[model samples]
Target: MATESFLREIGGKSVVEQIVDNVTNAIINGELKPGDKIPTENELCTSMGVGRNSVREAIKILEAYGVLTIKRAEGTFVKQGFDSKMLYPVLYGIILQKDSANQIIELRKVIDVGILQLAIDKLELESLHKAEQAMQKLEQKLAAPAVDINAIFEADTAFHMVLVAITQNALLEGICSYVDQITKKSRLKAIEKFINDKATERFLLMHRDMLRVVKEKDRAKINEVVEKHYQYWEQVTC
Candidate 1:
């Protein structure tokens, strides 16, 4: 069984990525349940024919993403219940890192517009308020003498996620989680390059404008701002 599933021929992916997928798929298929202990490192390497490094690296990634928990003396056990947090590392390792930032920018446009429409349909006043608060957090980060890239990204991401949350669409939120990870990774690099550029300030203002439009529930303007926002990132990131 391990030979069939875990020892499959490696495709384009690295061994660590393949191992992550194999383990994730096993969990998804119900073959490995929550709280179930996975095979030992030696057992996995022997079964999958991967080196110890690959197995160790794959297990490390899974642990970081909350997929598997390691006990000091005992072996790793599958985490109880599904966490949305688990999906992004798997996605980043397997899909997004392999793809270009341009693809992410394009996807952001489509996803954000759909998210805005759903939020508009619901017209939740509280969502607008939360988005405004998130925008303020981003503004504060941007206005600081020194830029903390992670804080800016967290604030920016929180604003978008808040908007998406208003839609009450579980599937959209999950997809956004993957996108969020990809965007944050890219943003970290981009901010390093553009630290002195005044574009950073305008970027903060762009989100502020977006929040203002959401308060007005202006569909046309919301779409317009979202389009420009993602397009700007694609250009700058490159």
Candidate 2:
């Protein structure tokens, strides 16, 4: 296939950025398949009518996003894990830095509630087992004379993420990941407050009961528990 057929002359955008977009489009369009070597610098220059520096820098940008990987003897190959999502860290970081605890708690409630309803259809014992493992880890963390809030948060996040995983929705998982990332600091602060207030035991018990209701396929009860959990979380966090 001809490289010129895909790449175009750089317009208003910076030459490197344009090349990056073009190559990214190529990947999305499957013109550049996974493990396929990217066109050499000379070919990219000839195809896009850009300079060698532009092509090299463009390849570097793609590589930073996990889109392309350079080999010593070979060449740059399109990486398989090249989702646009790999670029979301900066955006999520910026948004999360500006977001408030209240806003995060509100978003958490909405996203969790929606996912819980959807999860009921495909709920299985194994899924419940995963949740139970995570919950037990949380309990163990809290039981320590000196609780590690971060460990508690990790366990809590795992339990919640496992619930969503049962639905097997990639987009949903990605969105939840962003929410989880954004809420990390807030969750830590809230957990610290909740622990000092001696509310950790009730929280852990609620989650254990949550596992029970989910295993029982009790959607109505689980929904109520989820709503109450978020509310209690907000009271502590906000």
Candidate 3:
């Protein structure tokens, strides 16, 4: 390949951006494949005729975005795919700033209800069994005289997570995990305030409704039940 001179005469911008763009375009154009080693820092310095520091800095920035992955003994390589770890810290930052809980919960209501509708179309026997198991566990936990806060939270998280898991979408599951982390404190607070025998029983009944609709493959029923159930949390969080 005839390498373009990324450091040529231009306005006084640094070569780092050109280097990053050239490399990124190469990866996007399939010139680079997953596990393909990036040019060594020394090699990039020589090829781009720039300082080693410039190349090193660009690589570091790209690696942070999930465009590249570095293995300790092995050299850097194009990433297999974008990973959620890239966005989780950013999501957590947004949550910590405490500006967007309602926005996030609203987004959750939209996405989660959509996932349940999809699960209705694609529900497998195994997924229903998993949901049932989660539900039964919730029942057992709720039967205790003094419910464990963490246990109830985990069961509730698992119950909703299963909805995304059964949809068989890795990205959706990753997103669910991210959102769960963002709202963990607020959700726990809501649970502390709103959870009781009545609330737990209502949730169990909602889960049963979801399972029944999924088992029957009724899209309308599944959508209705899921939206109603999830709206309960949105109201609480709001």
Q: Between 1 and 3, whose TM-score is larger?
A: 3
In terms of TM-score, how similar is model 3 to the real structure? Answer: 0.77
What value of lDDT does candidate 1 attain over all alpha carbons?
0.76
- Which stretches of model 1 miss by more than 4 angstroms? 1-99, 192-194
Worst 10 residues of 1 by lDDT: 1-10
RMSD of each: 6.5, 3.7, 3.7
TM-score for each model: 0.58, 0.75, 0.77
Model 2 Cα shift for residue 147 (angstroms): 3.8
Clashes (N, CA, C under 3 Å) per candidate = 0, 0, 0
**What value does the lDDT take at residue 68 in candidate 2?**
88
lDDT of 3 at 108: 79
Best by TM-score: 3
lDDT per model, in order?
0.76, 0.76, 0.74
Would you list the rank order by lDDT, best first? Answer: 2, 1, 3
Candidate 1, residues 1-238, lDDT tens digits: the string is 2333534555679999998988888888887889988888887888877899999999999998889999988988899965676666546654545455676677778888787777778757677777778778878887889778888778778888888888888768888977777567776666554556657766766777666666677887877788777655675667
> What is candidate 3's lDDT per residue for 84-161, written digit by digit as tens?
765765666666766487778767777867787778777888888898898888778767797787887888888888
